[model samples]
Target: MGADREGGARRRPMRAVACAAWGILLLAGCASMPDSGDLRDVESTPRQDTEVRVFAMPPRENAPPAEIVQGFLEALTSDDPQYATARQYLTPTASRRWRPESSTTVLADGWDIEVDRATAHEDSGDYAFTLTGSKVARVDEQQSYTPLDGRYSQSVHLARDKSGQWRIDTPPQGVLMGRSDFQRNYMPVNKYYFASDTAGGTGRPATAVADPVYVRQRVDAMTRVVRSVISGPTRWLDRVVRSSFPTGTALRRDVTALAPDDQNRLTVPLNEKASRVGSERCWEMAAQVLFTVQNLTPTVETVALQRADGSTLCTLGADRARTVATRGPVKRPEYLYFLDDKRRLVRILGGTAGTSVEPVPGGLGEGLQRLSSAAVAWDERTAAGVSNDRKDLYVGSLVQGGTLGNAVLRSDGKTEDDRLTAPSWDARGDLWVADRDPARPRLVVLEQGKGRPVEVTVPGLDGRVDAVRVAADGVRVALLVQHKDGTESLLVGRIERDGRSGERTAVSVLGLRPAAPDMEDVTAMSWAGDSRLVVAGREQGGVQTMRYVQVDGSTPDVPAPAALTGVKSIAASDDERLPLVAYSEADGLVRMSSVAQWQKVVKEGAAPVYPG
Candidate 1:
């Protein structure tokens, strides 16, 4: 009876549909499926102009203090050129004081703002409000990106004017907007900075360094980007990087905008202050300008520097500009390394037709077995790995006939999951590892030629450090930390070392910040290019995906090609053009080349790794 009743109820919807369609064809419920050959993918979304403007509602006449404040905040997200609409909510004095270009604080959406009414007093009409939200990143006065995490609060006060209208009497400088508004209002562009390879002895050619920063998409973006490059690196990077632009540098007084000629030649006029640099420094400065501008408009193939007198001081073309001070002495690796089916180290050399897979030579190549994870040094002379039992970490020579030394490090974890993570070797030959033993977690660095490991402290991390990868520069370290809440976070922190003294050195992590906050369950990450990391993770607890993210935690506008699903590990060289290598469940080990397609490189491999 229940089955029949259920069948009757199910047929009621079909009967109603057929009855409703009787006038047309009386076959609505029996419509045939479309032909398989006729099926098509949805049309791609139309590309949007980078400088497109977003409109915001204007302020109403004689609005209350809270309403005026809300309108002003909303208008800040729109492209009003000079923020004319937003200024209406401010007093004349405050309007002149509020400089929207001073800085930008990007907040996550869905922030709740509370407005507190004032009690009846001498300033009874005054109102106070508080803003609270997650800080994603900040563009300082110099327009450099600084990754920020945690909640932020600001108290804003508003007052009623004598004309019976509310206005902001004291307003803050710059602007604050949600990430959604920020995406619509601003676009990211690269600014060039010179290489500061503190660990350069490993023998690798110098490569380009592109510092990603955000600028107003449409409002004089070219001019703004160039000026920002001349302003020098951001505060977080100022001490670790160098710039060619001299102090007090600026554009020529007569020129208001940077324009390219028909033949694709862009001429930038500098004030007398910037003309004092030497020829080599001048070339670097030109390269900086060229890289910054070309990132915006491709029409500019060449750039010429001019003086206040309109005289051409120097000219740099695309070919020579990219080579300026960017070449190092070592060749990049042609093969991606990994662990073979026998748990021995192996490699797959990439080529045009296909790749040749072979086992690496040496004790690690033929003798070592049951390896869980590994890392090859930047010099390609040494390697490190953890035993399958997860109790021993070994360092050995990477060349043929080389020996796998006794376990240099050991784990105390009682379970396999709590064992040591994969070892990573820095450019300076220092091997880093994290013992994930829940009973006694630790982060240690095995300096070259040292018997014991040095413990490094991660000050503010409220979790266990799971993995570690130090940058080639030896100044920054990337850490995969498992938080107390059972979620993993990717963090980058500065590696602060004690000044060179007569005694031995000490190093610790300070000012640790999130590098990929938008991602959860990040399984693997590698340095893909300067200040950029290619990460593999599941976002929002969905299927795993691979993407390139900035070290400053800002997502790029142009998305990277998606990696094959279920990629267990990923490896990338600092050279951005080189293909990325990964190990997946279906396609053993594959290489993702320039075409953004995965080609099988190794038939059976696991734990793929690349030299730093």
Candidate 2:
């Protein structure tokens, strides 16, 4: 929300080959070499200008029923004011009753539009066609989108008018479009909600979760974003987060626009039903609005809630709204921690003036050996690691006099790829891991550093999990899975824990769903912000690219840094504003700071990571 801009000018090709690579990431094999020599001198391909919203062409006169239907569907994707041209294809009564803004179903490319002429009667002057395609996302009545399965079929009915001109008789209420049209016509916007609860240990206030949804790029986007937040969280995340807006909340009558005042404080008018709530509830709702608006438009620094008469109910500033919802560990250390050349854990203080890196003054740093990948607990007292051989998984103390313990979990040492993935720590101090060992391919959740590992049941999980990352809330686990066909994808599942009070002894995964279903060949992933992740992998069969994707699989329009080609690993703070750190073949260990430029942070470093 700071200087970070979403959806810059990065352009994806309109060709089928380009989309095919992005849709499933069908890679023949992984690339072993770097793609770019100088990260600073590289320039991304220029994007085509897609800002022109209104279409120049209108419905042709005396068009047949099929052509009229086609013209209407295409016209719906334009930015024409009031859709005056599109309405010409519909009967007067149908046009009056139809609302294109009701909902939107985003479909995949290459959909077949078939007109059924088999049943047509010569005298009836009526025709029907079918639209069939795989869906990517569905924007519902309130405009909240859920990224679940998108296989859809809709029938369009057209009839001739009294004047003998073809017009839509029973057009669907909402709109539908293919992915390419969606990309060029719509834009992704995030609606803010609160985390389910405060951070467990430190009592940090609940943080805001940004739910990414798409809306018309130039048409009433602000209105759509606000309305969706008021409606509630999307279907996929309803159980994971909370919203302050009341159940029956709505915008006040006669208020059709949202604009910032000269002072940059945006005033929002809610219906009288919302004004009936108590002051505390009102403030919370105000925080939700403040956070949501600020993300969409950065110039808004404050938010004022008001009623129909325009009398301000409450005024909230940006500073207080920023920390309303927290994610990740309760207490993040001042330094970014990673494994050093000596095979020990080290820290590089964040925001420190000079670039001096130092190792932890403890047994964990001195006693550990042959370390390849490591993760520090939120408390910063415990550390977990996998041996360079990927055979052993260990958890130990990070303090001065503490000992480096032996492996709590081990993998089949048959091959390097069969070894365990680097461990992940949850807010409850639970350690999570997955073994690619085909003989024992399974996910385990260990209680801190002791007890038997609990095997999580993943229903319909078609492949072996390669890496696992648990969210700070301890309810979600992000996994990178390799399918039977050798293609990889990023999936997130709910960790079903058993225990309301005391220590939880049982854990399992349910509803395993792909976080980025369309993206394949996912190599690395880490929690970047609340309900968001920075994924590193190739959408195409080439060098890996990095982008910040929503946990629900929706990618924001914001411009992410250029792809760190040949990147082996990457790490980021739960707070989005913090600099991102990563290890790559080209740069060794590098960091992106305030200027958002990548620079070397350490000459010899590997497996960089952050706390839970």
Candidate 3:
């Protein structure tokens, strides 16, 4: 009864006067007299628009235990502010203790309610029901969503009040709802913060990293997102990112419902704790706010920070904020590079189809050392290519008279398939590659493509690394791992560097989590945006398909990209304006245009990649 019962046989008829208020009209037959020969269920179409608000009905007088439980579950999924109606089903003490906003548990389907035969009976003063469902994910008090796969079972106790009305005395602490309702009621927004090590100055702009969180869509989202940004980054990203706001920073007392003015300017009044910061730090704080707010609404063009006493701290416009804290790649890639038919590095103008393909300006492009796969640095000034046999890796300059040097690294894997995968570069200019040697597999990083290769320690790793892709942020790395049973999964790990100043550092990849848990076999993947990756993989019993998944292990609300067959490798830019390029076995090297159609770029090319 706790599940969605609107389409069930137990549907209740609404009063005529309340029909219009609910935005639905109930029609009843007045002249029906004949008995039905065949019984068929009549189904009502569900609302597809999120802007349509659904209000929960209050509990009926003298309601039974089951109805009270069902009504409470329904109310949790409504757009009612503060869930006032839902609390009515609970006793005063339980209502006060319940914090619906504390967290949200989302199930694959609405919860099932069944009375406990051991203690529940019609004449019993207290009744107990077990609510159960398959837990799919959860959003904590911080609004951070983490994927889960397990069963959820909670006991809900109801007792008869003095007036003989049933009320819940033991309700779940936080609200629980189905996945469909959660998606409809909440929206994901990115809160921005500066990378810890990349503080702006000295010819380098501090890079902004996106921390995504879910918030109720119609519930003063602007103010909630602003408060979340001020609170600081989530625990997972707190180590690698930092906020410019001072300790104990918060919004001014009595401040709520922050909205932009007619001029598209947002003024945020901070508490006294943030009042003493210098002008430069205040501007950085404003940059964080400006970047975070822009993702929520496009109308906000500028953000002005104010002290508790109403004195202006700093003001930042969208244009200046970008200069202070840049997002994504520092420089746009000029060309999409890949290996040609002869295993030589070649390139074509990015985002353009039918353009003349030319060999890149570097020694690797001369075809002297046939290459299997390659990656170009973000600056487009250097390139790293794996040898045709996939054993030796070479790094060379992209200059007119550049010459190929000796292989900087090598793998001892007996066969090509178990050797070095394609290399990738991060914004910090460091190169990352994975060696799939079964005897001794390792994830290695070249510090600025020089010095000894740092073998990254991946704790809790249960498989060998097959492919590697480092994100533009330089704080996260994505790896395609092959399990013992031969199944491959896509995982993202946090890149941590620890050591003393001016001393040798220890680099490791920690907290490896599945980014595409449902994909049975991930053939390829690429970072498509700040926190989104475009993955090509197959489900347990499904065919290969390409979809976007967030680094936090959640699927995005947007539609999947157009399907391409036999995708061997894929390439995408953090800049969404650029088209997606991939090497498909059926169609050769191809790129998806702005119109969502794949256009052939070359008849024979592989390992398509954009400068990381």
Model number with the top lDDT: 3
Clashes found in each candidate (C-alpha, N, C closer than 3 A)? 3, 12, 0
State the local distance difference test value for candidate 2.
0.70
Point out the worst 10-residue segment of candidate 2 by lDDT.
Answer: 9-18
> Please, what are the lDDT tens digits per residue for candidate 1 over residues 474-504?
5567888999999998888767666474455
Weakest ten-residue segment in model 3 by summed lDDT? 10-19
Distance (Å) between predicted and true CA of 161, model 2?
1.7
For each candidate, give its TM-score against the true structure. 0.77, 0.80, 0.92
Question: What stretches of model 3 exceed 4 Å from their correct place?
Answer: 1-47, 200-203
lDDT string, candidate 2, 387-419, tens digits: 888898878787778776667888984998987
How much is 124 displaced in model 1, in angstroms?
A: 9.7
Task: State the TM-score for model 3.
Answer: 0.92
**Model 3, span 1-612: residue lDDT tens:** 343222232212111111233667543321221222321232211323654565677777776777777678777877776999889989998999999988999888667675676667658788887777789889999898888889998888999887888899999769898787788778889899988888754456788899989999877889999999999999888988989999899999979689999999999999999999987788789988888888889779999999999999999998887778788888788889988999999998885665688998879999999998999999999999999999999999998789998999999999999899999998888999999998999999998987789899999888899999998989889999998887888889888888763576788898888889888778899999888999998976999999999998888898888999988899999987789988888999888887889888888899999997
